[model samples]
Target: MVNTFQQHQHAALPRANHDERARQEFTKSLKQFVQQGLLPGLTPVYQTRAAKAFEKEHGKPPADRWDIRKAMVKDLYFQHYAATNRIAQELLWEAVIGSVERQLPELEKAIADLTASNPAPLESDPAFPVPRYVSALDIHCMPGGYASEIDGKDIAQGAIYDRGVYLYAMGYMGPDNDDMGRSVCNYVKRKMPGFQPKRILDMGCTVGHSTVPFKEQFPDAEVIGIDVGGPCVRYAHARSKALGHDVSFMQRSAEDTGFEAGSFDLVVSHILLHETSGQAMPRIFRECHRLLKPGGLMIHADLPPFDLMDPFTQFILDNETYYNNEPFWGAMRDKDQIGMARDAGFPAETIRFDTAPMAIMEFAGADTTYTEDAAEALAEREFTAGEYAPGGGWEVLIAQKAA
Candidate 1:
């Protein structure tokens, strides 16, 4: 008989062409076998109409890496669509262990053979060092978060999450899962799908994951990605140039970007605020206000600070602050980005956009607040949608300035 996880995958079949369906099926089967017959389930939320719509659009055809950013935001958000992430996390380590246990002998022989022949180095040294910040150290359970090189310092992270997924993952660690630092930028691109800004600025764009998608979204726009990390910026720039995307990476602070006033039509960030101290948020908000043109917009895709949701949901979101290395997360959860944007001079009566169409999103409660037990259940079962909607975290909103 077909097993539970494989059964689940088939149950949630993706809407794609015959060949694409075949490929996805093959991929799933390979993953299942490779992981010793384990198949992670889809998120409870994956069954929503919005998710279905996204899957429909995604199933159509493949695009270049540049064009793939359009898919990045939704794909990142798709983490909540299946229960697979939880299993994937556990299985990934298993895969590593299995690779060691089963494939080690062959791997050793291959390594010896390659070393004897003198393998090639990928590239020369970078121009600068990756940045360090008070927030980055404590924000994501990743000390030296954005600065650590995949090859050296930590060794396991950089290549695994970013380069490994490539276009398939929008080259990021998913929403609020900013392993590649792309969360902030991908959120902006997906949220403002219609408006093509002339000049785009990505604040605190850790590794440029958040920055490159804008270039793909608006090929004509002058796109610049800035971050404090020297290594990440250097790596990001090199990656962009190699991929032929016209993007510029710089070393700068989001609190004070040091750009001319009214320089951009869109200024966006992803998962940036929670890491920043409460004192820093106001300044960063003010900076965007000054940099944006009269009709421009400033948007952020961040963890839902207690500001938007209910007491119960608020507490749940707050727990990440304790366990997830996000010291500033609770304060961010409590701060109002909409109110902050309005106060930041985004013009009163701002309009926020929801990426999922109303038909798919079913406009619900005040951030869908729930009880404490529900919240804990949510963290574990968050990837699924239909069942876990009561506990909210992946909140998506876009605030616009008056014309």
Candidate 2:
């Protein structure tokens, strides 16, 4: 077995420095305050205010979550929470970028050596068109988003994302920020014990954190990760190589990957759907269908759908759509994913949706118990209705091609 790249221990990485550590701590504390102090206290008050307003205006309680969200926007508490959250997010990235900028030359030299030690194949196309969904805005308030370069050979965006994501997630993604990939892989193993895929593909595999877990889970599979960002794939290749994994990292769009039809036995994505625009989703789903072999599985792990959660919870989650620069979040969440899969040519009966326990939560001593029978039972059960459980698990959509 190859040695896993323990991100926290990697000396060449940005987080190893004192400045980055302090920035991360500050970001973590800000996030905790927003999540623990502001959100919990403000939600009920906002709901009550919205409820009374709705009754006074329409002679009844708010019709749905959308109405509540609309009303909450006018609430002072909600506005304060939203503004504070945005400031915290922006400040987090500022600190990360500042730290990287301070030692760009040294960090550049360091990554060159780290990536050179065990080089994996990296393919990038200068002629490749950058999608509007990616290029339009600075998603997550990052200065240049994921596809920008400071200079001709800059990897600053990649480095910033790699180091800052853990802090952004407040360590919920574990020390490596790879729980999304690990959780999905674990679900596949328990649900399909006999299914051994020979080839695997991860779409939108930024920095390849999500890509490496597949290699760890199915060591013999030929793994390939593709993204539109050149720096992301480059950093991913270097990270994979440094970690002793032999996965190929390529710069390509998920909506139209250049791979041949039926080339992969399994295709997966982690938190990629919401990042894409509504117009791009159908094409991406079709691409996944076109890429998978007969009977091959395709799974997408992401945030829970809007309908599955209460109005308040939905309102809270929708904050990303407005403040975090993820404009497509609401549109994607409102989508019927299974319906989209069917439109992409998969049979209706083959599509499945279920929530899986997060790998990091499980590893961190949260309830890790999940058997095939238990998964099946959860699949049969309806979506739980109440306050959304934070750090509980992830929602997954699984589809299989016809044999």
Candidate 3:
């Protein structure tokens, strides 16, 4: 099938001119080709040649992903596959950066105006110290990390991310790139039918792509999205306003958000844990527990543990740690998250891992690309390492405090 995917336009998103649009489209197509056409070859290449070669060089065949990695890295096919994947990622960000930079002044003004008119709170602290994990390197090779601001009020990083994610995901995340949050919300609604939260907190909500869905799901709830990146939260506020959601956005770290104890009925994060360090992960769980009220829910939607997948799949997913700027990508999966939740004060019986079925089918008629057949196929497809979100659903770590 010709990839008919296209990102739906929004006011806060950056506009791309003809040439820029072509470049962005090319990057997206290249990524699709990498995932659909090229990604599968690694398995055959590894099984047939790479593994045999390793056996010849050493005594035994590869025993684990580490051993498999040692074998595959030397093969020409793996080299080409890895290089093309990295190039696609680098191009994906570059394609969006120019559009954002050119429209910086206009984008900033528009965001400022949108945020000013929105009744919800938008808070930022210039004195807040950005964690070294974020500042260490430009994550995902995006030139400036999420926190970078121009004149202490930049929105370029957020705009770039907003546009870039569509290309990066090949439009699999729906028009707004909010599939993860939407999936989790659907899970909550389906699993606990009567659980309507009064206050919702989204931790590490960069640009609020995943945050706005909660407010949409629970209109009566007070939804708030917090992030350490000032630009991210600023853009999130404007984006939420532009999307017609009254959600608060604040510059705050997930490790120790200064919210009062038991202030929120629901505290969640989407793909945020993998980005944080080993030390930060446990603390974030504790913070989530602290922020949540008695009988409240805490959910983190992220990649499943390394132990769940085969060695080869783990090897494929580990490529993010080496190629992409995701420092904790591989390591985070190794951490015992259920145990961490227990340590964070959640009872052992209350914590478990669950699959939140992808809400893609709900978007069937929302966009041309999201046809019923296509959405169903995406939702039912098997999980492949290195693809965007899992085919079946988002893996969510869920816990509820004792009433």
Candidate 4:
């Protein structure tokens, strides 16, 4: 069976201009330098300094990550490291947004034409309200966050995210930033070889980077991607179309997708929980439950919970909660996702947590196959103490509703 919907080689649309390309490269390199060179060298010195300071003051080593964070804030080395990383993060989005702003009219026209002619459907509501959590600040310092629009038909937010995320991820998300979905799909195939979903839903699917891969993996399934951001869905629909993947992109809140109950067989979200408010997360989970059919699977891919990480690593990861305007990351990381799922009506015994190796280098003709044992091995890999490895892989929380 030749699947016409099979995705071709990954590619970026509205090709970056020379300046944009240069900026993206610079951002990528800067991020790599910060993560690999600067952070690794400074962490030990900062830790030692912080521990000594804590002992001197409290007659003990730092009792917890909070104590370490408080002491480290006073240390010059930690201060410099945090400041440098934050500045680089801001500059990355600035570069991408600057490039996009310069070509806004052309990019908008291109997206408009592409989406209009594309077979994949796009539905957006002008009346859709941007949640206060999203509107409060520019998450990750991306100007205007994900919902902003300009000139009534703007795709700038999507363009910025699409371009900036590659640099943000430092290529760990594969060529087209679809590794989260691909990794989750691989895990599902290995874990439940006999289970096949007829309908798949991706929530908070920005620009469809994490949405299209499901169509690639389950070519016959009806794949739909939804986000609260209109500009995001608009661009996502166009991007999926451009990539020759069949998908439906809609502007809708995950908490209330307006779909009939039990309408889907699989519901997934990639790195979305951390961006949602504490008050809204349970509702979102409940909505996932409501949307899925009997025996349907709900899978969420995100960073490992703080309980699975060392205190120092937790402190390091929580920096985004304070500095990067991602207010809910700390709360989300502290959440017991299994408990939350159970509260949302999924059976406790049906919930599972695991990790999946990212398909970072696989999409470009590398062998993408995995055995069941290999998947289990990846999931069971012991957590290394004291390292904050975000995007090193995906931590998946999965649940199945009672049949």
Candidate 5:
């Protein structure tokens, strides 16, 4: 997380405020929103209605799809409400991230410090685990995105995160993750002419954000989500149990999940690749390959490759991939994932990368299906890369497994 000029806008030379009135008002509003507009009172009802409507259309729920209808309301309300208050979200992040953000300067200084300190590498120590990649440097802008279990309990650490986002994710950040969840779930439910998945697995399912969607999509499939974080697994279990979603969450590194080969009909991940090291990416793809049923599918939702990004948007969004605790993002875009998919044994033609239209066929008051005029089809085709608009970035690469 450099404060340096060119890189972070400060990376140019290396350098870099807000006011109190706007700050206090923003904080007050946030507190009010949390206290009054969010959580217990509001989210439950919203998610219930959303869930009931889906259940009405789909019939019964999967084992893990328990009371998720309730969780959905809280999740959605927070996302929509926060997006409307972008300025407030920025203020809040400045406040919440201040402590972690302060340590950024140390990263550059550490490079100098490590050199000056003369860390000895013994000739005999050929196997010493020196940091191998540029990714080890920033760690996705996270304080320690790459560290292996600083504490004995990696899940606890992740749960702390789950709690934080669960409580505070105000706008797009919340929805970017959850909107993908709802979109995927709703999409899986409607069926595109004729398609079906027998079993589904979600990778990097932090607190089940992406995993929950599959329940709505293929209600009959056995859905499982795996991640390295223990807190996320434990909490995901607890939350899913409460919500009545029968899905399973497990604490396992995505790299080597010990599941049966060809056991899953679909393996899914949302926004996980950018946060992982390039070296780790292939292993994850292979794991998905090992876990999928023959002709099963693997699809992921994440930021598009650099090929699709404009310079200005690229600089802005990519800057976060660097400074915002997601240092691996740039590397992920740089890597040719098609090769990885192929290495994992999928036919080149089988790997379908499409940015499915984000919206579902309909909402209650609207028409049952959304019509796509010629222009609309083109835009929908670009749904993965075009929706970021003037403010945010784009989405690309649905990346399905071969038939």
Candidate 6:
């Protein structure tokens, strides 16, 4: 299916020229082809041959995702599939990186110009220790790993992520890449009436793609987006301004944010947990519990656990850990998130997993390319293992602090 979704451009975004745009579009199309054309074939390849070969050799069928992985690795089709995905990811970043580098000076100036008049606070600390998990390697094959600064007040890595992630998701994240936050906001509004928060915080908010939606949804609330990446916060501040929101952006780690206790009424994160180390997730959860006031809420949107899916599906999703540079991708799925939340001081009875339907359909006719038909198609499709997002909705882990 042709992806009709398009990103809404702003001053902080890198302007791609004719050739660069073509290369970026090609990478997006290639990724789409891989997900649509190649991914489904894995099931047949495994059930018909790979599993049979493993059973023949081991005297039993493959037991779990690990066994599935071992069996699939020897298959030629799986090799091709994995190779193409890695190549496409590399190409996606390369295409956007070149575009950003070519116009780095111009992009920086645009960010400066846009941020200058914005009233929101943009705080950063040069001495803040970059966690080893983020600083050690380039996560998602990103060239600079989200924290690198090439020059003074550098925001190159953030710029690369801003555009690259759109292509990476194949534009399934809506025009502004705010679907996760928007979905969560919609969930709160519909599920919890009369629960308007006065103060809100978003943790690990890279580039503020998912951060701006909260300000838009709850205009009266004081919204702040925090991240450990300096460049990411800088770019997020500028991007938030360019998008016409006065949300605050700060360089802060969720594991130990210095905010006062009970400073916020609602704390949220989108697709952030799986990227953090095992030791950090629980700390982050505790911090969230501490940051929220009585009767407040903590909501995290991320991948569901391995126990919820079949072994074949688990193996397919685990490809991120092996091929991509996501170190905690697979192991994170095994973590006891509910138990961690309980330990974090959230009441056990208040903790539950729920689906926040994608707000894509709500974006229909909202000025971008999100046509009603296209949004419906995206929201109604079956979620394949390796697809960008689940079809029904994003899986959200939510808990409420004691009142």
TM-score, per-candidate, Cα-based:
0.53, 0.89, 0.93, 0.89, 0.56, 0.94
lDDT of candidate 6 over 1-403, digit per residue (tens): 2348567777788989999999999999999989999999999999999999999999999999999999999999999999999999999999999999999888989999988967999998777797989999999998889788755488888999999999998987876777788778888887897999999999999999888889988899999999989999999999989888899999999999999999899999999999999999999999999999999999999999999999999999999999999999999999999999999999999999988877764434233455656655543422222222334588999999999
lDDT of each: 0.48, 0.78, 0.87, 0.79, 0.50, 0.88
Give stretches of model 1 more than 4 Å off: 1-138, 148-194, 351-397, 401-403
Give the C-alpha miss distance for residue 207 in model 3, angstroms: 0.4
- What TM-score number comes out for model 2? 0.89
Whole-structure CA lDDT of model 6: 0.88
- Residue 109 in candidate 6, Cα distance off native in Å: 0.7
User: Candidate 4: deviation at residue 270, Å?
Assistant: 0.2
Name the lDDT of candidate 4: 0.79
Q: Which is the better candidate, 4 or 5, if ranked by TM-score?
A: 4
Order the candidates by lDDT, highest first: 6, 3, 4, 2, 5, 1
Question: What TM-score does candidate 1 reach?
Answer: 0.53
* Residue 158 CA displacement from its true place in model 4, Å: 0.4
Q: What is the per-residue lDDT of model 5 for residues 266-349, given as tens digits with 9 covering 90 to 100?
A: 787887787678777899888888887767777777777766654433443453453344567666776788788888887787
Candidate no. 4 TM-score: 0.89
lDDT of model 3 at position 266? 98
**Model 5: worst 10 consecutive residues (lDDT sum):** 1-10
How many collisions between residues are there in candidate 3? Answer: 0
lDDT of 4 by residue, 155-231 (tens): 78898888788778775555566778877787777678788899999999989988988887788999999999988
Candidate with the larger TM-score of 2 and 5: 2
